[model samples]
Target: MSKNLEHQFSMLVREVRKEFVGNGPKEISTRFVGNWAISEMKGNLTNVEKFMISSEQGKQMVHEARTKMVKQIYKKAEVVNKFEALMGAKVLRMFSDINIDEDIAMTVFVFEQSIESKGK
Candidate 1:
């Protein structure tokens, strides 16, 4: 993704974290993945597959959740503008193979992204 999009995604993650403070990074990771309807697709999903391809409605719900999360970060922007800013962009893509300790993975990725961007 472009740096601008990556920055925005990072900001979204930060805003999500801020809203869930004291619940800690594990809670943030849970929230981030909360709306995914991948379980429905798991009937066909293989152990090697990281993501589940879902129905249109499932995808729509996921989109809406992402939008809601982004809006929490950039509330002053118009809806269209916020959607444009947040859509299809990520600073760091979460792994398809979830680690045994996924929360640790998420916290590390978030901190790494922030640290890497500091001097840029």
Candidate 2:
């Protein structure tokens, strides 16, 4: 995909995260590979979350909550529709994971067709 399209996708990801999670990552980079749009996000932890991760139990709880919350957010019809519209393809699946220690996250969207080709 072109750099412009990738940038748009990155912004869309950031916006979705901010809208649902109440805070967007400080930085995001997105790339198209095969039928997937993969995004790497940095600085996703809020001040409260940063403090919570200091305890082992708090760290586990935060990780579990964040992971489940992200999955549920992506499963929403509105979220799925927005991504499908942006990529011009049906969404097949979505995957997300976060590392509390590093305050980093990765979100991957799988489309029914190659999004790279659609961008051309």
Candidate 3:
């Protein structure tokens, strides 16, 4: 990106970081690889897909993925921090610090609504 864009993105990321930090760590659920599959698994995938592609069951996937993810997260602080910063910004922009999950869901709903409304 251009210097100006990078600066703006950095500022936005900083704002997000502040909100996220202010809310604290335990309350704010961040993904450390394991968290991703833990929070995102559908529990309804086909056996074929799970076995052939994933090479393991959902639980095993969570364990292995989490281990790998945690390692990557620890090794690459800069990239992880940037991702966290973006996530924080997005969460902050969409919801109050008090009710993060609900706010995030509502934000998505609202964005979808806006897109649909615009399409109409």
Candidate of highest lDDT: 2
lDDT of 3 at 10: 38
Tens digits of per-residue lDDT, candidate 3, 1-120, equal 333333343344334434432321222221222112011111222243235334435445544443343343334456445534533321111221112112221101011111211111
How high is each candidate's TM-score? 0.25, 0.96, 0.22
In terms of lDDT, the poorest run of 10 residues in model 2 is 111-120
Q: Write the per-residue lDDT of candidate 1 for residues 62-94, one digit (tens) a residue.
A: 444433543443343343244234543222322
lDDT of 1 at 16: 46
Per-candidate Cα lDDT values, in order, are 0.32, 0.91, 0.29
For residue 32, give model 3's deviation from the true position in Å: 16
Give candidate 1 misplaced runs (Cα > 4 Å): 23-85, 88-104, 107-120
RMSD of candidates 1 onward, in order: 13.5, 1.1, 15.1
Q: Largest TM-score belongs to which candidate? A: 2
**Model 2 lDDT at residue 96:** 94
Flag regions of model 2 displaced more than 4 Å: none
| Residue 85 displacement in candidate 2 (angstroms) | 0.7
Which residue pairs of candidate 1 clash?
none
